[model samples]
Target: MESVKLFGTWFSPYSRRVEMALKLKGVEYEYIEEDLKNKSPDLLKYNPVHKKVPLLIHNGKPISESLLILEYIDETWPGPAILPSDPYERSMARFWAKFLDEKCPPAMTRACMRTGEEQEKAYEEAIEVLTFLENELIGKKFFGGDTIGLVDITANLIAHWHRFFEEFSEIMQPPLITKEKFPNICEWVNDYTNCSFVQENLPEKDKLAQLYKARIQAAKAATQ
Candidate 1:
């Protein structure tokens, strides 16, 4: 049997996505939890440059970056397909995943954490970015059409984490995502989070909310 191990923190969306992919592939591996405050030696050694969690060690070779790790898992294992088979569709999947990772999180964070003008600017940018995503799901059940795929997996942040951030920030800021503004996305969130496999891998919402609440408080304190 091949040696497979994953180093990740429980509350990280990136880490959780990787775990979801591994479980989807039915790949049994060791999971090592990392404390972000104090670095782990093995994590540092394997991912010297980033020294980040969600690092995959397969047969002793390390793969960093959650998306790359997901692709690796799909290609290496025989199970449900993560990306599309067609070249164009696969490229589009990758495109949207990149867009989400690059565009959404920073804007969402600023929208929730910043105040006044900065928050307004971030909110507009986030809406624009999310509009693009909403249009992408026009007639589809998932980013992968009917089943979970690369884009769907990568969107765990938006579907899961963003909701909690909105709940915790409602007093300080308006919600970035809502049924009124993004119905398609709202439905997608319902579908994605309801999946039994996805649920099993998700961090508990209450715990995640507490973490985000602390982070939001910290960010506000820094700005003040």
Candidate 2:
């Protein structure tokens, strides 16, 4: 029997994406939850450079980074496809995923967490970045068209996690993400979160909200 183990955290969208992929592939894996404050020894051993969660260990070989882990899962497992088969479509999916990871999160975080001029700049930047995704979703139910695919999974941070910051932080004035501004993204969030597999893998929203609230409080405390 092949040995599969995953080191991840409950609240991390990165970790959840991997779990969603594994479950989608019907690949049973031993899940080891890691405390981000004090990570496990095996996690350090496997992902020495980053020393982060969402590390995948398969038959003694280790893989770091969530997107890479998702690709690995798609290639190694025999199940419903996580990435599109066609080379062009697959490349496009990877492109969008990379764009999301590289461009969206930092701007969105700064928009919510920073103040005054910095926050305004980040908010505008976030709107600009999100416009691309909003346009991409036009006339499509999912980024993957019908079924959830790599882009959809990678978007979990935007679809789900970002909401908590808006909900829990008072500093997020004027709001970076809104239904009026990005209707297509709103619909996509609805569709993505409503999916059964996604629902099963997501952390409880209330709990996540509290975590964000505490983190926001800590950030404010530090700034003062």
TM-scores for all candidates: the values are 0.97, 0.97
Residue runs of model 1 more than 4 Å from their true location after superposition: 170-173
lDDT of 2 by residue, 115-144 (tens): 899988888899999999999999999999
Per-residue CA lDDT of model 1 for 1-224, tens digit only, reads: 79999999999999999999999999999999999899899999999999998899999999999999999999999999999999999999999999999999998877877677887898899899999999999999999999999999999999888877877765435577889999999999999999998999999878888998887777667867
Clashes of each: 0, 0
lDDT of each: 0.91, 0.93
Which stretches of model 2 miss by more than 4 angstroms? none
Worst 10 residues of 1 by lDDT: 166-175
